[model samples]
Target: MASPQPVDIPSSILIIGSGVFGLATVYSLCKNPLFKDTRITLVDRQPFPTPDGSSIDSSRIVRADYASPPYARLATLAQTHWRTTFAPSYYHETGLCITASGPEQKYVPSSLANVQALGTDRVEVLTSSDDIRRICGLEGGAPGSGNTGYVNWSSGWADAEGSMRWLRGEVEKLKRVEFVTATVSQLLIDHTTQTVSGARIKNNSSTSTTTLTADLTILAAGAWTPSLLDLRGIATATGQVLVYLPISATEQTALQSHPTLLNLSTGLFMIPPSNRLLKVARHGHGYTNPTTIPHPESPSGDAITVSLPYTHIDNPSQSVPLEGQRSTRTFLEQIHPSLATRPFAKSRICWYTDTRSGDFLISYHPQYKGLFVATGGAGHAFKFLPVIGDSIVECVLGRTPEDFKGKWEWPAERVPEESWEGDGSRGGPVGMVLSEEIAKTTSKL
Candidate 1:
């Protein structure tokens, strides 16, 4: 298939998702002088900053400790934006304490080196577990105690919901940006021309469906991307679990003084208390749902798509996976032993649009002209909330960043499928399907 022709700046753009990527794109376009006359419309299944969207979490770590140089640079740039734009209220510069044990120990030195390569020593390596505790006021012991890591003083976390609200406010200031609450059912495609006109949306408050026409349509729908687009080998939806533990006022204060804790190799991360809630989530193998729908027009007669609203199946109300709960407990107990027995305040399985490779997939669809995609969070794009839109804008203009040359486009071959569970003899991707039986079992737990 030939690459879709580029549209430098479309007169009308219909964005079918209002999460991080969508909002950021709108904000970036509004700022560009070339798009001064562009009429932009953003539609989502729910209201702006929907609670279930990946970007609307309680809090997300905002650090630039990526082992990859491109991401390191992008994260550093985003860190600067977070500080200036959302600071004090939405962004907290509480720092991040990254630790690793066993074979994962290499991440510590490598992360420090990556930061140094940027010609800035924003991190300070701790000598021992005692130093780790003292330097960060964390309950976990030092490197000798089982983990070795450093503190990125310049990095912290952002109040995700607050940041989303702030972004929406900024976008609303633009006369060209329009927000709509509706579920995009399908893309309006011209079969003869092979060009996407816009989207077919179902109004959230009514049963009526409407066709929204535009010169261009960008899908930034996050986990729901695969359901809307046939991105089989390019991206998959993976479910990550997070448990929120409630603490007392005193405990919250003490924990607030600490930085975000992470065990890089284990995909285990800890967010300090926010409103008496401390959260722990895993970034490792996540789960997936094998969903399909009938499509008489398709050659296969069955199309791979998630159930509509996408929230009915995967939402905050859903229970966390059993294994996810177990792993989170084990890691927390290992570090903060005192809080080991504390009852969890709440828990849920958060979904991520994971690419086989960890980089984002942002480009024009090879099969559909005037259609673009900006997804592939891979569970880490939230940190780049500020500048990620610029990357997308560049992609739409046919001038992507040098680092994104091959990384952000569709792969030539079908990439090997990844397991939600680690690559071991244990639970693999095959067993990660979210069936009704599995959901019932986890909910009982």
Candidate 2:
């Protein structure tokens, strides 16, 4: 067997967005032996520490307690990459704690079985409520009794900003990579040829606009992805928010020692912070179009006043106040009465780019050739950025990726009929193959 020849691609590639996805993609591309000689330029509206930027938030937890095998495999691969390529101090593997109550709890068993079938050795299904208490210190448990528990040792938290800083540093070290502060205004597509040649970007100050040409362009603008694609007639769903709060000092101590906790009954997860704060947020719900909502130039003030439904509570559709921190505190108090008195240190709003099918819409535009769109992260997509970057790079290079078929397949249905389950297996079949390839390729570095 002969080795695959290195691809001598174009010298320049332009990436729009400086969030985790964009940054990770640029880092991976620069590191790839095939693109070692390629020059990469990343443009974003905000500066490096993008204020209120989705990627550089206070803290983000990483885990592998997915209901599906594909996600589990991706998480396993990403975790290994983060630990090996990035500093160990950047990530904390406290593990993951998942619990289910009432009829909703049935999903847990099937989810566990799926991962086990994939031969993942990181998960352990706890038999008794006592086991949950012993491992996670949470006292609630019952079959259809609003209580059930499971543990995954491969789950934990990572310093999101720290990770980005490390990645950006690496990318900057490459003589071929450059970062620019600007907003991409228009994608220059050759209509007759059906190919994207470059982009015209307006600086944040709006005093000047410049055009940069590239052989390929990638859209990783997070929540803004849909709007950008809209100019090209591609429709995308706006993703919702995940709010986090801090627990009491005592409870915080226990939770810090505890694994990342996900209560299926409430559709909420508690992530321990590396800096001693606790994060709680809801998962799987879609958000209204952010374009309809006001864009807050600043992260402070009235800009944060968007209404959010309390999906984690007993009532799924009930409307309530959008108290990012207060809601988190109240939910924690209900689950573990002990946290009622703890003062909230802070709160944050995170956004996800959703798709109609509840899966990521990472594919090439049917009409716009050479213009790759990576949106619809659906909510749990952050953990898969490393491999997702690999896939995106492959797509831009016009190579058939093992994971592309499954990812680009358009679903007949607009949105998933059922509620989004976090049991992990969302990535289409052939997930293991893609995951293994990513691990093998990335592990070499």
Candidate 3:
């Protein structure tokens, strides 16, 4: 497709966030001839490799198996990179077994059709619970983990942290982007002109606030994006649950090659064991932490309530609440009965910047001339680590993929998050408040 009418290239660009979107954009900017002369600056509150950031996790799914054909097609293209040049060592193609029970079963066949449409011939359809158990190595699990599903040997996972580290090294080798470590307090907005010039960043160690001015500013702060803007109903941060169980080498070797088992009905998934650690996470309507803060775009200090991320940084001793733990345990009993009673080595609350439709917000700010947003991961942006930056750059230059033109654009009107018709890929309970779940940590589900 032809590119859109090009916007004037800015002399300087500043990106806030070091996750895949931000870092990959840096890599793409360095490689793009149009941006070769643009002075780029990447600023993050934490040092390289954010300990609590969702992208810096042990694993992330890398698959083209999606109910949405556009995503499935794009993911298939990205999977080519994962299989070849982009962090190939970190990529593993053991397989992915996507399943569902009850109402979530509606998503399974559609996803299967998408993969088949992509010409993937390594798919094994499971028509019954026994088939699911057999393909996923869940014979030892409970009676029925799922009723229907498929195992795509072509689909796989990536070592998330390793891939990010490699990409960071690749970006550093280019030496085009000046990396800054500081916390962004607020945006430097030109209230009169309705433009964003840069941001007010504070250095934690020096205890001083400084201004970072750029001709163009891209906000790709993932779950923290809404905290810097008045995105109340437009987008919200939803914390998902994760539990890590340490297994013996003997057990790990036995299950290391098994396909990742994910049940959309319960939003529970278990990737294959690696490094003696097995992670169980949920891909669902996660828990929201509603916080009230000063409206970011208002000059007169207006308070707005939005769902923002609250992580271990907010509470050092925090762990996944009892409700999340119990839910995972119940799934474990169904999938891996032997490990149902096993103590978890650790737990975490990974947050997703969920938009109303689960689509990424990656376009110029409607109200601000010099600002652009590239966040809203919604729990599944990591797989695009290899090429999302180039796509973001395309949008920045007034050009977007034909398939994602409307999908990635900023909405013209605001809508309540609750009213969103999602991509039909999510499961689990809804309207779960984080505080409420945490409060029930003392009680059993």
What's the distance in Å from true for residue 80, model 2?
Answer: 2.2
Question: lDDT for model 3, on a 0 to 1 scale?
Answer: 0.87
Query: Each candidate's root-mean-square deviation in Å?
Result: 3.5, 11.2, 2.2
- The count of residue-pair clashes in candidate 2 stands at 14
Q: What is the lDDT of residue 213 in candidate 3?
A: 96
Which portions of model 2 show Cα errors greater than 4 Å? Answer: 1-8, 105-107, 120-122, 127-130, 139-146, 231-252, 290-320, 323-327, 341-343, 399-404, 409-445
Give the winner by lDDT: 2 or 3: 3
Ranked by TM-score, the better of candidates 1 and 3 is: 3
For all candidates in order, the CA lDDT equals: 0.76, 0.59, 0.87
Q: List the lowest-lDDT window of 10 residues for candidate 3.
A: 1-10
Candidate 2 C-alpha lDDT tens digits along 28-72 = 788788887777888887889775566776566676655555666
In terms of TM-score, which candidate is strongest? 3
